[model samples]
Target: MAHSPLDPASSLPTGPAPRVSVIVCYLNGANFIEEAIGSVLAQDCSDWELVLVNDGSSDESPAIAARHAANDPRIRTLSHPDGRNHGVAAARKLGVDAARGRHIVFLDHDDVLRPWALSRMTGILEREADVAMVFARTLYWAWDMTIGKEEMESSFAPFPPGRLAGQVMLRDLIRWDTRHPPPCSIALRRDVLLATRGDGALWHGMYEETALLMKILARHDVWLLDEVVSSYRMHPDSMCIKAEAAGTLSNETVSRDRVRYIGWAARHVAMDWRSRLLALTVWLKGEAKLRLAPRR
Candidate 1:
């Protein structure tokens, strides 16, 4: 499943390296829109496009997007015509469709990425001959502006034959176990995205990025960046932190998704028993926490 780099500029309207589409999908993130856009603008690397998709906002979001668009030619906004297409998933789909760059960056509007996030990520993508996506370590920026340590750092293991994830799936097993999920640290190739036709339904709501990651793993290798190339804002307004506080996704859903995920991995993916069992164990632990959280 190793793909030759497709000219790095073979996308619909743009090429690689210099041109980038840093997509920031949002609902009602008017409060943080400027900060988010500014993060991308502050990048040391120039020649990037900003695709901002507004998913039916009731507040000042549209105005905010317009204000930025009016000033910057590289920035553009698309409003969700149908109400059904207004969630995170739909907004993401729209963002991907609107992207013209060969390299696609997925960023949350409420989250602030680091100055070198795109530069470093795209650099690795160019260097790594077999990588499908490049993921960097992110720093935790508290409300007090205190940057905490990196959450989950990868081994940065080189790709095994036929892309490590794809082979695991080909063997009928799951190859990934997420101790935690970080949204801002991921950057992907446009062809890898075009392969999926920019379907955000996989990443529609809660575990959207998780689903997207799985799809990418199907055909390519995810190269982990040891450097903290992005910064994630921690606060009460964040949807994920709120979900954790309310115990909405809680644990049961996670446990079930794990079973389903591994099943999907083992059934459709090509992997063996050992990998399946390991994935199962991880899911079971998550289930235990889910079942206990309510009582606690």
Candidate 2:
């Protein structure tokens, strides 16, 4: 039996709050959960806690998480009531609510953080009070768990390393005019995340991170680092890969999601006129893609 969110007796971390909380939420990711957790364990920074949220994984993953928790006081596990299969957004919300940290970092079960990731990111956040979040480049790993030399060389951010205004980042993200960091490479202030998330209603579907990023970048400053901080595992089991294999991933589906996100952002995120125009432009482009896509 899995622990319920309503259960007051559910074991969670207590005592002085750690400086950072690393949240890894998953559903049936037994194959890579250990490596993911290992990366966190390998972090040079020790002022952090790990929250593993099992979103109704019907595999050995829950047990694996339990074993890790047993070995380390900094780790704990969570799940929905009766082990319900909530989506990633809800699972992440559960972890965030239970997290006891000033800063938050999200790592997917299939990804791994570099050893100095936490140390470097936390140092930036501590030194820059105005930066609501910080992110570094991510290395996209091949299926064999190795990065190609060319991929490694190209992992650096194209933009200059420095602080960027929230609206500027949001506009670029909406227009798809610039590269954005993956979730694994980001560390944000918990309060800013909480405020941007606001009930997590807009994040239930695909492109969940995009929805969250639009809001955050619209309302807060972000620090961009020109270094790689994590590795994103690209394998057959990844959501997009599986979807693509099944023929369910298409331009139409992407366009629909993009439109939904744009609408949500227009309603939720406070943005200037230029940002709004860029969002409208992106929306039009998505509509065009959907219209031009050849019928299967």
Best by TM-score: 2
Against the true structure, what is each candidate's TM-score?
0.74, 0.88
Q: Can you write out model 2's per-residue Cα lDDT over 1-296, one digit (the tens) per residue? A: 77543232456666899999999999998999999999999999899999999998999998899888878989888888778797888889989999999999999999999999998998899999989999788887776543121244223335578898889888777766225777899999999989877744565565678778777887788898878899988777786555555554544355455566776776666788999877777777767876776644
lDDT of 1 by residue, 31-142 (tens): 8888999998899988788887777677787678777776776777776655333577767777787777878888887778789888888887778767877767666667
RMSD of each: 8.1, 3.4
- Give the runs in model 1 whose Cα sits over 4 Å from its true position: 1-18, 83-85, 144-181, 197-204, 248-274, 284-296
- C-alpha lDDT values of all predictions: 0.64, 0.80
Worst 10 residues of 2 by lDDT: 147-156
Give the worst 10-residue stretch by lDDT in candidate 1.
3-12
What C-alpha lDDT, on a 0 to 100 scale, does residue 101 get in candidate 2? 90
